[model samples]
Target: MALSWDDEPTTAAPAAAAGNPEASAADVAKRVNADDKRIINAKTDVNQLVPFKYKWAWDKYLAGCANHWMPQEVNMQRDIELWKNPNGLTED
Candidate 1:
C-alpha cells in the first residue's frame, strides 16, 4: 500500500478520558477484587482458568498447560506394542 495520505483510511481522535490516564497499582487491585466475573470469565488470557472456580482442578489444568512436551519424548511405543498383543502381556 502506498504511504500517501489519500490511500490511508481516516480515523477520528479518541474521546478524552474521564479519569486519570495512569492506572495506579491500587486501581488494578480494586478492579480485580471488585468483581469475580472479570477474573473468572470465558475470555481469560492464556486460558489460565480461575483458581477460585474449581480450586485444585484449575491448578492441575494450569500445570498441564505449562508443560511443553511431545508424547514420543515419554516413550509410549512399548505401550502401543503391548496393546496390539494383550495376550502376551503380563501382570507386571
Candidate 2:
C-alpha cells in the first residue's frame, strides 16, 4: 500500500487537532512500523492507538473495557487471606 503524507485526510488527524492537548506527529511520512496498518506518517500514542499488527492486544483491551473495572473497586481481602492461610497455599 502506498501512502503519501501530502495527501489530505478524510478525517482530521489527531496531530492536527488543536483541541488535543498533547500531539506527536512524525516529521517524515513514514510510520514507526511500516508493516503495521497505521497512517503513513501519523504520530499516534501507542497505548491509545490500536495497530492492525497487534489485534490480539486490542481484543484484550476491549475485553478489559467491557468489564468496566476499577482497581479501587476490586476486593483483595480474599487474596490476602489466602496468602496468610498456611493450608490453602504454600511458597514454592
Candidate 3:
C-alpha cells in the first residue's frame, strides 16, 4: 500500500523543554535517512511533493542546475556577486 503524508517518518518532536541539543541529533539523522529512503523508493516527482506555494521557488532552484550549469559555475557566480556587493542585502 502507498504511504500517506502522515505515514512518513520524522524526527521525534523536540523536547517540551530545552535540555540537550546534541542528544537528539543521531536519532534525528536516523529518522531523516528512513524518510529519505521512503521518498526515493516511491519515486515521487518534485511537483507532487512540494507545496504549490513553494513550487516556483523549487523550479527556480532546478533551473540553475539544468543544461550545462555545474556546481563550480554556480558557486563562482555566487562568489562574484558576493564580492561585488559585500553586504549581500536585496530589496525583497
Instruction: Please report the candidate that would top TM-score against the real structure.
Output: 2
lDDT of 3 by residue, 71-90 (tens): 65555876678768958866
lDDT of 1 by residue, 18-91 (tens): 57545443454553433233443334544354655767887887788778787857988778888889596888
Write down the worst ten-residue block by lDDT for model 2.
21-30
Best-fitting candidate, measured by lDDT? 2
Those runs of model 2 whose alpha carbons end farther than 4 Å from true positions after fitting are 1-64, 90-92
lDDT of 3 at 83: 63
Compose the digit string of candidate 2's lDDT tens values, residues 1-92.
Answer: 55786867676344645564344333334455533645666566444555546889889878888889777788989988988988869666
Residue 64 local lDDT, model 3? 65
Error of 3 at 11 (Å): 11
Q: Which residues of candidate 1, in runs, are more than 4 Å off?
A: 1-5, 8-66, 88-92
State the weakest 10-residue window (summed lDDT) of model 1.
33-42
Clashing pairs in 2: none
True-structure lDDT of candidate 3: 0.60
Candidate 1 lDDT for residue 37: 35
Model 2 quality (TM-score): 0.25
